[model samples]
Target: MLCLTGPTRAVTIDPPVLLAPMEGITDRIFRSLIAPHGGLGAAVSEFIRITVAPTPQRVCRRDLGPPIGVPVALQLMTPDDSHLAASVANAERAGAAWVDLNFGCPAPVVFSKCAGSALLAHPERIARIVATAAAATGLPVTAKMRAGISSPAHLRELVAAAAEAGAAAITLHARLRITSYDEPATWAWLAEARDALARCARPVPLIGNGGIETAADIVRMRAETGVDAVMVGRAALADPFIFRTAAGGPAPTVAEASAWALGYLDAIGSGSPKAKQLVRYWRCAGMLADPAQRQALLRGPTPAIAGFFTSLVPAGPAPPATRTSG
Candidate 1:
């Protein structure tokens, strides 16, 4: 277990497995499901775009409210430094424990606006943005970034600038802006980042992300990259029980897992049309271990789908059709 002192207080992070702030995947329903698993140090919400105007009070109340007692960080993506600063202040007022600047999302739509990975090309702008956001919120600030724009040469400079601008920590995805899910993650890049971070004059914890799929993988990544923590993105979707397994805690039975899903549906209400779509998208992201089971659950009628997931527990053998794909 490693304890890092944030702006507020020391946060004890064991095993240091974090749930990445995936846009569609890290909603309240999923955060509730994954928090009880025990190995997670922090859970970040999906990136909220900070616009020129302030976020509406009602929307902020609904979206930024605490999902759980665990340290919840609010992620914001914006090209405008002033706008991003306003969003960070709003997030703090709305009860965010930390503010995370997103500079790693590869979405073309986001990059076109000079946000996300596009910030990588201008390290000075990144420093200014980080400084503004960190100053706006007295809370600890962090940044999630790609390895580099197109080469490793610029990554160290970006990290150094973020740290200089008051970022409490940095999470490196260990891939370039153009590296998609199709390409395998290069673990060596994480090691190089670790070395670079160590050379920085100030102390900043480096968190490794990408291609971590299991408890074992977390251990391996920590050993290989020498990072303070491992952030699980697609893998958490594959098995929400990963943190629990890594902590040597009991894994939820299949029935228990299903019941957890049912609870989420109940809390959110499946009556909404979007609820059904959420079920399909969440399962497809790799939360279900069995492919056949996942398909069966998704294809079934609403009531059937709810019942199927509610009845599963952790004891069963892998569903025969289980195949790993992101």
Candidate 2:
């Protein structure tokens, strides 16, 4: 287990691999659906914006979900610290294990609002926002950031600001905001940030994110950068069993994959547009091999698609150890 400790809070994140919070994805239902599959240390909520006013407590509770099984960290994004403390209090009451500040999102809308990665250009603002959240809640406060805005010139200051402001842990995405997602993440930057955090008075954990797609990548990242943990984002969309695979567990069989797809469909309800979109991303669907044939099945009505997934499952006893009680 990896423990992220700060002055007033400590969170034990087992497996040391987390699910990156993706906007428009990784919602409560998505998290619940993936939780049964093993290998997650924790799952982060998509950032809950605290803009002109504090987010209501019910919204925080819905975003955080019930604190069962995998611990969920509520992520917050804002241009300034205006409603940070109030939002943090709502998160605490909502049962968030920890809180994460967003400084890595590259969306133009968020950046235009002076939120998300826009804050990467202002290290002092990040410090103030983090400090506000830290003081408002006993829950461990963390920060997620990219290397910088246009360059890595102020990367050290960004890391130092969050750490000095009492952040329990910091996750570095290892790419400048101007860089495209297709560009290779700079592992050297992770190493640089690791070195910077080591110089902090408290030395909070550093989580390496971006461009990690396989179990081998996870191992290589830790060996190369000395990050305390790793976080997986888009990769999990393709392979829900990624965490288990990274932990050296057996890969899910075709039958197991079929079962999961079918279960996911059931959870989202039959004929859901969401299921159609997300199903296209699953590795199991890739089993179809032929693009034309795959599209034929994927585009069909929900019932037909469900039947196709069911056909993939050979008649047999159900898979074992698919879900953890926790």
Candidate 3:
């Protein structure tokens, strides 16, 4: 747990931590595999790109059967205002618990459309989009964003625009649109976001994302950045159980991870699509293993990877990698 200093820190969201939506990762199967793991309180679906036409409910489902135990923010990505509003309504009609706008994706396709981080320079436009989505859905609406398009600064003005526009919460990914994963997370930006929100009349919870991988990062983030919580993406893909450990839930063993991994692959099915998704996913699961062991598994096939996990996990309560506890 993080110690308090200066003024008291409060988080309105429960579990306080959340799993981030990643392309190909954090999909429906991945979410179902990890959602019941005890620590995660919220979920965000992979970006549902909005077009001039309404997104089909079949596509909106994205294989999410139902809200198992928690609320899910169906993230809609688009540059069109009317389409965005329509998309949010369509998502809610299809059983969305919350609506999230994607102003954070830095993908080439997202850039070609001038959505996502491209709107960072246009705070007024971002505000207009948030307001439109919120009014359209009449449900809890949130947004995820990078600091800026070209500059690493501007979190102050950006966050206030989001808050005043009626976002129930906002997540700052702490990087510029052009910044890559090799860059360290600008945690100071989160501090800036907190201060900016504090000055707003409608200050909402600030959830920090980017570069939060280890259990230590989670604690330090809450204590140092003044964020209500942290969001995990690639690291969670490497170790799904990291969420449980970082948020004070019982940790899963190697044997457990092995079983879950096998089950997830099975659930995705054995078609060509399964093989394609599995290979890409296996590369990520290497992050679950220790450094000394990661490369071998990264190079090996699924059976070898599964065998490695089975051999390592003892037939007893597993010692967790994280120190976080309830």
* Model 3 agreement with the true structure over 119-219: per-residue lDDT tens digits: 88788989999888878865778889998887856778898998899888888999899899778889888888888998999878788888976656777
Give me the runs in candidate 3 sitting further than 4 Å from their true place. 1-13, 270-293, 299-326
What global local distance difference test value does model 2 have?
A: 0.86
Q: TM-score of every model?
A: 0.84, 0.91, 0.83
RMSD to the true structure for each prediction, in A, is 8.1, 4.9, 8.2
At residue 166, give the lDDT of candidate 1: 79
| Predicted structure 1, TM vs. truth | 0.84
Predicted model with the maximum TM-score = 2
Question: lDDT of each prediction vs. the true structure?
Answer: 0.76, 0.86, 0.73
Candidate 3, position 13, lDDT: 41
What residue pairs are clashing in model 2? 69-326
**Candidate 3 residue pairs that clash:** none
Candidates 1 and 3: which is better by lDDT? 1
Ranking by TM-score: 2, 1, 3
Q: Per-residue alpha-carbon lDDT of model 1 for 160-235, expressed as tens digits?
A: 8887787888899988998887688888988877777788787688888988867789889999889889889876
lDDT for model 3 comes to 0.73
